[model samples]
Target: MVRVLLVDDEELVRVALTAILDSAAGIEAVACDGPEAVGLARSTAPDVVLLDVNMPGADGFSVLRELRALPEPPAVAMLTLLGSDEYLHAALRFGACGYLLKDTEPHLLIDCVRILAGGGVVYVPPQSRAVMGTHVNVPLPAPAAPELRGRVTGREYEVLALLAAGLSNTEMAERLGVGMTTVKTHIGALKKKLGAPSRVALAAVAHREGLLDTASADRP
Candidate 1:
C-alpha cells in the first residue's frame, strides 16, 4: 500500500482531499494541519506527501525543506490554490516532486500520488505554462558559468528538460541512469550556455526555449 500524508491549513480542504485519496485503491492518506506536518511525517514515514502551499505558522516550502532533510524523505507535492510561476519555481527549488492546483481532478490527483510513489513527477497545469511563459520578471541570480555564448549539447538539453520537470539532482541522476558527477556537469554546462544562475532560471529558460512543454519535457 502507498502511504500518503496530506497537509493543509483549512479543515474543509483537508477533509475533502483525504476523502478523495482514500477512495483510491492501494493508497491510504492521512490529514494534518501545517504546523504538525513535519512531526506527523516523521512518525508516519509516508511514501508520498501532499502539502499545501500557503499555511499559517510554516509555509509548504519550509516544511518541504525540513522533510527533505529527514533520514528518509517522502515524495512531496505542493498543493496550491495559486497557479503563479513564483510558486511553481519555488516548489522546484525546494525539491518538490509535484506541483498541483487545488482544482485538479480527483482521479488525476489520485493518479499523481501513485506516480510520485512510483518515482514519477507531475507539474503545473497546461494553463499555468501560458502564465509561466509570460513571467520573465522572476529574479535570475548572477551566473556562475564561465561563458554566456555557447552551444547546448543534446544531453544538456535532456538535463534542462528534466530540471524543468522539477527533479532534484539525485532524482535526475536516477532518471538519466547516470552518476551524480555527470548530472552535475550537465547542469553546470546548461547554466553556462543558457546564462542561468539557478535551477529556477534554468527551468524558465527551458520553458522559453521550448524544451519544457505543458505535458512533458523533451530534449531538442
Candidate 2:
C-alpha cells in the first residue's frame, strides 16, 4: 500500500483530497494543516506527501525543506492553486519530486501519487510544463560567450536538451535509451561544465547560451 500525507491549510481541501486518494486502490491518505504537516509526517511515515504551497505560518516550501530534513523523508509533491515559473523553480530547487495544481482532475491526481510513490517525478498537466518552458526560454544573461561552445559531450548535450524540456532523470533515461546512472553522470558532468547549481539552473543556462538551439541543429 502507498501511504500519503496530504497537507493543506484549508480543511475542505484536505478533506476532499483525502477522499479522492482513499478511493483509489492500493493507496491510503491522511491529512493535516500545513503547521502540523512536519509532525504528522514523522509520526505517520507516509510514502509520499502532498503539500500545499500556501499556508499560514509554514508555507509549502518551508515545510518541504523541513520534511526533507527528516531521517527518512517521504517523496514530496507541491500542491498549489496557482501555477507559475517561480513556484516551479523554487519547488525543484527545494527537492520537490512533483509540482501539481490543486484543481487537477481526481483520477490524474491519484495517478500522480502513484507515480511519485513508485519513484517517479511528476511536473505535468501541460500548464506547468508551459510555464516551465516560458521561464527557461527567457532571455536571461548567459554565462561567458566562449564558455558555451563544445563544453559538453554529444550525449551530454542531448541530456541537457531534455532537461530544458522538463524531462526527469527517469524520463530522460527512457528517451535516450540509456541507464539512469548514465543519465545522472551526464547531468553531473553538464552541471560542472555549465557551472549550474541545479537541474533547473542548468536548463536556464542552456537556454541563455543558445545550447539547446545549437543541439537541435546538430541532431539528425
Candidate 3:
C-alpha cells in the first residue's frame, strides 16, 4: 500500500482528498492540517505527501523543501488551485515530485499519485515549451555527439514513446514484448542519454527535441 500524508488548511479540502485516496485501493491517506504536516510526515514517514499550496504559516513550498531535506523524503505532490507556471516551476525546483490542480479528475489524480510514488515526475497540465516567453532549448551536456540522438535504439525509442505516453514499466514491457528488467534498463539508459532529471524531464526534453514528432523522426 502507498502511504500518503495529506496537508491542507481547509477541512473540506482535506476531507475530499482523503475520500479520493481512501477509495483508491493500495493507498492509505493520512490527513492533517497545515501546521501539523511536517510533524505528521516525519512521524508517519509516508511514501508520498499531497500538500496544499496555500496554507497557514508555512506554505506548500516550505513543506516541500523540508520534506526533501529529510533522510528518506516522501515524494511530494503540490495541490493547488493556481495554474501559474511560476508556481509550477517553483514547486518542481523546490523538489516537488508533482503539481496537481485541485479540480483534476479524481481517477486521474489517483493515477498521478501512483505515478509519482513510482518515481515519475508529474507537472501541471499543458506542457508548455516556453520559459518566460522565450523558447526554452534544452542543450545536451558537454560535447554533443551526433550519435547521442540515435543512442537510444529504435526499440528503445519505442520504449521512450511508451514512457511518454505514461505507461508503467510492466505495461511497457508487456506492450513491447520485452521483460520488465529490459524496460528498466532502457529507461535508465534513456535518462543518462537525455541528461534528464526524471522521467517527466526526459519526456519534456524528448518532446522539445522533436523526438515525439513523428514528422521529424521515423517511428518504427
The list of candidate 1 runs beyond 4 A from truth reads: 127-220
Model 1's number of clashes is 0
lDDT of 3 by residue, 191-210 (tens): 78877645655666676666
lDDT of 2 at 47: 92
Q: lDDT scores for all predictions?
A: 0.77, 0.82, 0.75
Over 1-220, each residue of candidate 2 has an lDDT whose tens digit, in order, gives 9999999989999899999999999999999998899999999999999999988988789999899889877889999887777788778777687898998999999988887875566886466667566556554444574666656778888988887775766788999898988987897788778876445657778887888888898799
- For residues 1-220, what per-residue lDDT tens digits would candidate 1 score against the true structure? 9999999999999999999999999999999999999999999999999999889887889999999788877888899888777787677666677789999999989988887875566775676555445544454553333233136666776777777665666687888899978987897777667766445556766555554452243332
Residue 205 displacement (Å), model 2: 2.0
Once fitted onto the true fold, the runs of candidate 3 whose alpha carbons sit more than 4 angstroms away are 33-47, 65-75, 92-97, 105-108, 115-147, 150-155, 179-182, 209-220
| TM-score of each model, in listed order | 0.63, 0.66, 0.67
The C-alpha stretches of model 2 lying farther than 4 A from their native spots are 1-5, 22-32, 36-48, 65-76, 83-98, 114-134, 137-145, 148-150
TM-score for candidate 1, residues paired by index: 0.63
Could you arrange the candidates by TM-score from highest to lowest?
3, 2, 1
User: Candidate 3 lDDT (Cα, whole model)?
Assistant: 0.75
